[model samples]
Target: MIRKFLLAALLASATTAQAHEVWIERDGTGPARIYLGEPGEPVPEGGDPEFAKLKAPKLINHNGAALVRKAGYLEVAVPAGDVRAWDDAVFEPWGEAGKKESVVYYARAGRSETRAAMPFEIAPVTAHGDRFVVLRDGKPVAGARVTVITPDKWSKGFIADASGVLRVPVREKGRYLLSATQKDEGAIAHPSGTLAALHRIATTSFVVE
Candidate 1:
């Protein structure tokens, strides 16, 4: 019974770490505006809707120009060319046991999409159809679970192959989010004890008509 309880506790911890996802929510599109958030039921029930509570998130153009905007949520417009946005690292430390850190990103490819300029990042190594790759410190991360979400919260999960590439079929194509959660066995040692740290990253993109 004690062993079973420990197993359940471990599973619960892992699930909590996997819950962080970064995705884009499109509002109106006269010039094409997008909001960022973790797609969930709604706010107040653990939903951080519409880029709520984030600092001045910015949209960067391919030419290295950046536009900073402010709001209760993050809203930005992609330029006529390639653009991308990334979040500051959000770290969650639970007890002396360990910590879980995640960074979320969104990119609108102008020509071709490759690895993002993030330390622990995930991006599309292929077209936005289905295949993607997860990278930690800019290297392929195998064994990460990439959760694919379609409209209405329809979700399917895929595992990264040895090359850290994921291939999952896109059914219809509206808005999609691909999230990856990875946990390594290394932890930072504090004065308290050895603290375990898990790394997770996610990306959101879409297929347009």
Candidate 2:
């Protein structure tokens, strides 16, 4: 209960150290659209971290393409074969608006089935559907917020249990974006003041038909 309260406090904090979910969504073999901010809201046009800032989301495919994230959106070139992709990185800390903090963003999107074991990553534990497990440091992350975004731009939020497990019913028939976040209450010094750091992980998007 106490930990749940702390997670809520972290999400509801009124600082630039805001909790956010980022994902790359592709529609029918078309260009990918990267989204930032809370789910269900329209993807913003600016003020988003770029590939250089997010430490570059890695894409494993032919030629080992040079990918980039920009304008709160990233255009990805999908190769002509099954692929596994992921961008799991921690960025340099920044401060502003009387808040100091750091961000860790990670996401996976592709056709490959082998889900890489990642620190602070989300994995599908069920044979199918929207069930998943939230992992941090290779362990379960309980009481995390797992939000889902449908291709129609509608979204609903869900929570994980003590085992960091979540099962969200599939309600749409296009594409799906699953995301969750965790906070590290232990803070560090900053020019503005002491700040609490937050870590967020993006799911290797699942689909429902």
Candidate 3:
């Protein structure tokens, strides 16, 4: 009971940090599009302002794929593979007036890959399964909080166990988004300026059929 309470509290604290995330979506034989917004929310004409902030991320599992600007997302040329995206260009101070922090974003398209390819990543436990592991610097991040958005926009939060693994309950046959946030202490010196705390938000998307 105490453990569950602690997990719930952690998830609650990440509400604002995980409010919006970068996710990738790709249907069969379709272009892999990277979107910046809340899952299930309507994107604006050119995506949210934050979307504009997205420079090219260090894409894994594919090479030489250009990010084409679109009305609401960035389109990739890759048709398959893990096709993950990790961008630290958004490493700027964010938040209201005095309490801002340096934030970075990582995203992944849930393919049949079980290896961690980003500094912070959410990878499948098996070639085919709802079980996922949250990793930071190639290591499991125990107690990490994960929030999942389903096809119907229904959502739920879960805490990674000691092994940094969590099984998502898949009840529908459609796309799903999973997000997690990790906070680190200390200030950071960026070319832009000095940043307060550091926060990393990672999101993964997959289609379940």
Candidate 4:
């Protein structure tokens, strides 16, 4: 009988400690309860650091109706060590009172996929410079063709290697635009006899001086 009574008391205490509540007040006007749950429980914060970063939807009061504004969204991924440095990035509107609105967002750091961008140096070489490799998702894109066009109508072309990288020679030092295109043959074909599918294209521009 004593053991049964002790177990009942322990269970009641545990239940009370597990109960928790979270809420947001409307401009500090009154106590408005938003959520209620137990502590140490996981919740979806709405930010993914793996593939891309997006702004969290904001809650607003427009003439007593809740309106959401999703403009002014910025997406960027920095190095792992510089994650905390983004805290100082101002997220609020700067000018014009009528254009300003409250902001709400969530951040995720220390993810494994975060890395630095590739660095390239441009200098005047001979009629053509050494070739460089390009990879997407760490794999070569074979059969991909790269083209470079200069301001004087000069152009050169190269094909990507098995590793998805292409090194082409650039003749003449001036503003140049580089573009690549690759088509997937296995894509679903449309009935109109014209290929209607997705193609991967990457383009970059640099000034050779």
Candidate 5:
């Protein structure tokens, strides 16, 4: 019968080339077995069976806490700290990928909480030497909103104490292009927005010289 209709059209094109990415393995002492779907690209060399098909979903934080998911993607669990706030509910999909779907969000903590969100440091102002100090995970990110562009001058705002850190008081140092921003308080969700569609928010940036 024409090879049974070409074997059902190659199994319907491998089930429509299945997609829905996001996978991470390491489940034992701290829970880390997140998977979504179409998980078929470098995840098949163990118990085989196509690595059991891939579906995983029963997220149980248990105190290794921090698993936000509104727009999707953000899985902390280990010392769990850094992750200030950005928007997108905090991340938690499992399927129905968006952000231009083709999903691929995976995480497996440990190693001091994955180095505790390090990214924001520009120290170099030994006593008002034009000024420059913007540490993040190492502390000192007050107000947080610095922008220093110089072709002639264009400095701009914030960072003065809340522990997010920022301190750029320059007056004449030249060669500047520093940038920093922080304005993600749940991003934009209004059912009375404060974070409720599952909640998630984390935004951090760097680049100072």
Candidate 6:
């Protein structure tokens, strides 16, 4: 019974980490910040352990840019073009005994730039950021779950259609952040070890007028 209880606790921790979302947001005419937490919530001063595992994410368009560690998030320069960020440094095993697997996270900041830019991406379908398509490896990830966070801290959940397109209910005019995730069970080798699953997380942020 004690072993079972410990197993349950481990699984619960893994689920909490997986449920966290990563996104990048920029205020008007300011530098972009990469945040990890539930949308609209205040980030902790030291950040979560999972968040600390992330080294610096690569800015797709701005290759040589630097990431400055802030109090609770990482800041980066936003160039004229659309901003996108990708990271896979959080490589560690999670889950209990028989179901153990490792996960890697990928994030994006802007609209669809290219497949090479972000392996997993949420591309805007409409001119505004209300509609999006979830893509993995350049292919549509149908039935993907997407969480939308409005400027006022309001949040809603939506699922992608057969074509991977999803429409978000945008009510006000401010910054919107959308997060989507996809999982692949194929095995692959990494410096950390052999990864049994690939967890792809994509987020796109935009301002609506």
TM-score of 1: 0.62
Per-prediction TM-score, please? 0.62, 0.64, 0.82, 0.32, 0.19, 0.82
Tell me the tens digit of each residue's lDDT in model 3 across 97-137. 34546667889886588998889988899976899999999
lDDT, candidates in the order shown? 0.52, 0.59, 0.79, 0.32, 0.34, 0.72
Cα lDDT tens digits for candidate 2, 15-38: 433445556666555555555555
In candidate 3, stretches whose alpha carbon ends up further than 4 angstroms from where it belongs are 1-18, 61-63, 95-100
Q: Find the number of clashing residue pairs for candidate 5.
A: 22
Q: For candidate 6, which ten residues in a row score worst on lDDT?
A: 108-117
Pick by lDDT: 1 or 3, better one: 3
**Candidate 2: lDDT over CA atoms?**
0.59
Give the per-residue lDDT digits (tens) of candidate 1, residues 130-198.
567778788898877877767556878888999998776667746565666554456654333455653
Per-residue error (Å), model 5, residue 29: 8.4
Name model 5 segments beyond 4 Å from true. 25-29, 38-51, 54-209
Predictions: Cα RMSD each: 6.4, 7.7, 8.0, 24.7, 19.7, 2.9
Q: Count the backbone clashes (under 3 Å) in each candidate.
A: 1, 0, 0, 4, 22, 0
Per-residue alpha-carbon lDDT of candidate 6 for residues 3-59, written as tens digits (9 for 90 to 100): 899889777766766777677877655788887766556566677556776667777
TM-score of 5: 0.19
Model 1 lDDT at residue 172: 72
Model 2 lDDT-worst window of ten: 81-90
- Per-residue error for 28 in candidate 2, Å, reads 5.6
lDDT of 1 at 118: 53
Model 1 stretches with alpha carbons more than 4 Å out:
1-18, 25-37, 40-52, 58-72, 89-111, 184-198
Q: After superposition, how far is residue 171 of candidate 2 from its true place, in Å?
A: 1.4
